[model samples]
Target: MKRSLIIANRLREVLLNGHWIANTNCKEQILSVNWMQATQKVGNLNMIAALTFHINYYLVGLLTAFETGKLEISDKFSFDLPPISSESEWNKMVTDFISNSEKFADKVEQMEDSLLDQPFIDEKYGTFLRNIEGVIEHSYYHLGQISLIKKLIMQDQS
Candidate 1:
């Protein structure tokens, strides 16, 4: 398999399912969660919904760069999640994450392995390989937090 395909597959696994490193994925861990549960805080940590948005923000940015050759993410605004007033709204965001993950992976797979060595958009941001693999690493990092938060939320409900 091509290196791009390999990275894409890893990205898909982290965002969706069937990842070997973690038994549960981001979708499995949060997609079905009720709005109340998703928005609940575990002490001082970010809520599940907020974390979801944050993860998707970078994914969308990278995908944008792939499509338009411009990286348009701002860390300042990345966490600005809209009001998830109902389960439907929450589900929409979850679906957006899934959809973007698929699109991003597809785009990545289309790139040559040699492209990975080139800067994502410019030299300051690092190579495409670094950013792409960074997304996987970032998603896993948040997945761990989501799992722990879900546990905490469940324990509270019990």
Candidate 2:
């Protein structure tokens, strides 16, 4: 298989399903979480909803860069998760995540293998492959946090 397709599939697996390391994906992890638990502040840790939004924020930024050739995201506003006080709102966030992730994966899949080595928008930002891989790494890092937080929340409820 082509390198671009491999990277694209790997991204999809981590975001949606069948990730090798986690053995599950962000979608399953986020959806399995209770709505109330998502908003709960466990000690100094961030809310699950906030983490979800943070993950998607970068993905959206990368997608926008690919589509519009402009990178307009900053970390300061990345974790600004909307109020998810109701099940419907939480469900909507999850739905948005799924839709956006699908579109992002498709865009990445369409990239040429040569494009991977080319710098992403700017030379200082590094190559497309590096940025893409960074996204996957970032997702896994946060996925671990979400898993631990969920476990702690479950234990607290017990």
Candidate 3:
């Protein structure tokens, strides 16, 4: 298998699979979440919607860069937040995230393995690997928040 394909597959596991939500199973996390109450300063900021958006953001960026050797979205708009109005919207965001992720993996599979280590200067991150690894690290970071937030939200409901 190509290195890009390998990386993309691992990323897929993390996103659709349980890696997004603690030890939760992939089948469970895919569309199992309810909408998070819009970011209330008094409440948790890392809602499910935000995390979903973040995952897609990185995946798209990764494919565009490492695969096509370019960026799909501008840096300014890449990190923008998702709209969280209701549970339905959150579910839709989750679906969009998953779909886009698969597309990203497909794109990555087309690239040469040599591209993975090629130096590309990012405006903010300084290195291409750093940027890619940052996405994985960021996803894990938010996954922790998602797990904690889910607990807090569910606990309060009881």
Local distance difference test scores for all models: 0.89, 0.90, 0.61
Cα deviation of 3, candidate 1, in Å: 0.4
lDDT of 1 at 51: 94
lDDT of 1 by residue, 1-158 (tens): 89999998898888887568998899898876888999997899999999999999998888877889988889999889998889889888889988987888888889999999998799998999998889889999999999999999999999
Off by over 4 Å in 3: 18-22, 25-30, 36-44, 64-79, 121-129
- Total backbone clashes of model 1? 0
Least well predicted 10-residue stretch by lDDT in candidate 1: 11-20
What is the lDDT, from 0 to 100, of the residue 147 in candidate 3?
62
lDDT (C-alpha) at residue 116 in model 3 = 61
Please write out the lDDT profile of model 3 over residues 2-111, one tens digit for every residue: 77776666556565564433565332453655665323222636555565676677776766566575766675765487567776776677777777766765655565
Better-scoring candidate (TM-score), 2 or 3: 2
Compute the lDDT for candidate 2: 0.90
TM-score of 1: 0.96
Write candidate 2's Cα lDDT for 1-158 as tens digits.
88989999988988988658898889989999878988899999998899998999998888888989999999899988878889888888888888888888888899999999999999999999999999889988998899899999999999
Query: Arrange candidates by TM-score, highest first: which order?
Result: 2, 1, 3
- Residue 41's lDDT in candidate 3: 25
Badly placed stretches (over 4 Å) of model 2 are none
Residue clash pairs of candidate 2:
none
